[model samples]
Target: MSTPTGFMEYKRQLPVDRDPIERVKDWEEFHKLLSEDELRTQGARCMDCGTPYCHTGIDMTGGTSGCPVHNLIPEWNNLVYRGLWREALERLHKTNNFPEFTGRICPAPCEGSCTVGLIDQPVTIKSIEQAIVDKGFEEGWIVPTPPEKRTGKRVAVVGSGPAGLAAAAQLNKAGHSVTVFERSDRIGGLLMYGIPSMKLDKKIVQRRVDLLAAEGVEFVTNTEIGKDIPAKQLVDEYDAVVLCGGATKPREFNIEGSNLKGVHYAMDFLTGTIKSLLDSNLEDGNYISAKDKHVIVIGGGDTGSDCVATSLRHGCRSVTQFGTHQKAPLTRDPINNPWPQFPNVYTLDYAQEEAKAIFGEDPREFSIMTTKFVGDDEGNLKELHTVQIQRKVDENGRKSYEPIPGTERVFKADMALIAIGFDGPEQTLAQQLGLETDRRSNVKAKYGQYRTNVDKVFAAGDMRRGQSLVVWAINEGREAAREVDKYLMGSTVLV
Candidate 1:
């Protein structure tokens, strides 16, 4: 437990972000770190409730309520508050394999369920977690700890995303020879490309990758499972195979003129920009340039926000974002979305903040839908046709959207990026491996057991559970590794 009077004595505070104008000029992380004294004060704000729902790792109100990885939140918070930084780092690592990644990318459901949040603001759990890990790295505390002896068991992990990496790390700790295969030229699947560098620096991702390599996890990049190597070969060669190739099949718009030259899938644009920037610092001209173009990003999720920010960095002339649903309330609606569950509230994300700073107003427009892409004579996107929508519910409780009459309008756009969410895992490898799929097209695998229909084959992460958070992926990976270890050695000690 932290100081008994800390909650009332101090208020919640977070690290200050860099000036929007200054940060938009380059691809660097925005938030500056809080000083040690301030961090301790934040840590002391933790009440350490008897129930401690912050680490319950459960679902509430159609979304996650707590840390899916079940981190020891209160213990670490107390440790940090007591100035035991090293011990705090160890406690954090007990459950999470990648605190740095989660600290940066995760939406932090743990904070949503914080006991302290029942009345006042939530404790700064995410920032404290990041600070612990960052201090560990600066003081040379994080190092490779290879297994003492090899179990002589071989495991093949398909995909180098969060889940795959977590599974590989755990399996190697249990003395299994682990090999991770990535289709991209570099590892860290989504971490490398799906997310922008400003949000999560590539150097931090690569630093962990390098450490994993030192710990004896083999990485084979630019290798597709069902394409470069046969899926059957992995099952035949390795004692066990774990699939974590993330859900990547983008949902189709199916509207008119979607195939225009200047229109592209959000991942393609994001991946290309990151790859080009990493390879030659954007001098290679290998990515889609939004410079001097009027950009319209369809969909108002994290990806759409990322697109808006990336476009601004590319010097886009103007930007707009479309959302099918209405914007959430500025604060939690007590009657509708009460405490302990993630509040469906409107907040300015990094990109939206930058857009507001540069463009004078927020770039998002809610309760709108893009009807079609209007193309020029050269087959390039010239404009977007959109309409305002209103929700209607049928007697059966099914909901649908209807375009409001007299609200249809056209907006000029030189480039349009679709950031609508993914459907499920790409079916090529799963189909080739003869794995069963759910109605949603996700690979068929039980949650706790993580075993697919096929013998010696297991699945986890987005491939098994559909598109989800990095923390959930890590949880799936850790649990799946334990099950795989038991299946291989008859019993296991992995958690």
Candidate 2:
């Protein structure tokens, strides 16, 4: 346990982030690391509750309440508090294959379920996790450990995202010759292109990928199964195959003028920007430029916030985000959202914070729905028609939205991004393999078993489930690897 009276001595504190104005000027991570002494104090704040719900890894109220990867939160917190940084790193790596990734991008449901959070604030678990891994790297403690004995079995992972990467890492550790096939030009799938550099540095993703390669995980990029490489070839060539292809099919907004030139999906816009930045530092003229334009992002989720931030970096003249639902409360509603459940609270993300700092107002407009997109004769998006809506809850608690009459208005927009969400994994590969799909269009596989109808074929991550957090992907990937190992060797040693 952490210091018995530590919670009373220290309060929850996070490292100060770089100023929003300065951070928006470049595509680099904005958060600064805390001093070791300060971080140790933060770790000491962990109460080390008898029931550590922070690592419970369970679902509550239709959302995850704790660390999806089941990270040993208390163990690591105690280690860090005692100034045993290396031990903390070891405990962190036991469950999570990529603490660096989660520590950077995850929304930290673990903190929401923290025992201390029921009263005041939660321990800085996410920050401490990052600190441990980063310090391990800096101290030259983290190194590649290749498997000694080869099982002579071969495995193939379809995607290079978090799930696929986790599965590949675990399978390779179990002495199976692993080959990861990526459809994109780079090895890290969404990590390489989908997310912006400012949030998760591309170098950090590549660093881990390179380490995996050193540990003998072969990577083949720019190849797609069922297209460039046939599905039959992979099944026949490998003893087992794990499908981690994420849900890439973007949910479309079927409004008028959606096909206009200035209108694009959020992924396309984000991916293009990152790719261009990687290739020619934006000189290639490949990415959609939001510079000097009145940008309108349709959707108020994290993706929409990303669009707003990206547009701000591009020096957009004006920006606005529309949400279909009403804003959540600033604080948790105890009766509706009790303790140990993921809080449904209104908070500004990095992009929105930057937008607010620059524009002197939050960019989000809640309970507003876009009805149509208007464009000029040259096929350029120019305006958006939207309506304000009021939510109505019936006696049975079924809620619906009613558009208020005379609330329709036109807003000028030179560029519009659709940031709605995803439906499921791309169906091309699933159809080619004849894999069964759930009603939600996700690959049909039991959560723990992770096996498909086809033998030697398993699924995990966003492809198996629908869109989910990166931490959940890691969990699914690790679990799927255990099942795959059992199938391959008739028994397994994977955890």
On lDDT, the leading prediction is 1
TM-scores of the candidates in the order shown: 0.99, 0.98
Candidate 1 CA-lDDT value:
0.94
lDDT of 2 by residue, 87-187 (tens): 99999999999999999989899999999898888889999999999999999999999999999999999999999999999999999999999989998
TM-score, structure 2 vs. true: 0.98
- What value does the lDDT take at residue 443 in candidate 2? 96
For model 2, give the RMSD to the true fold.
1.2
TM-score of 1: 0.99
Give the number of the best model, judged by TM-score.
1
Clashes of 2: 0
Record all residue pairs in model 1 with backbone atoms less than 3 Å apart, i.e. clashing.
Answer: none
Instruction: Provide the overall lDDT of each model, using Cα atoms, as 2-decimal numbers.
Output: 0.94, 0.92
Q: What tens digits encode model 1's per-residue C-alpha lDDT throughout 154-223?
A: 9999999999999999999999999999999999999999999999999999999999999999999999
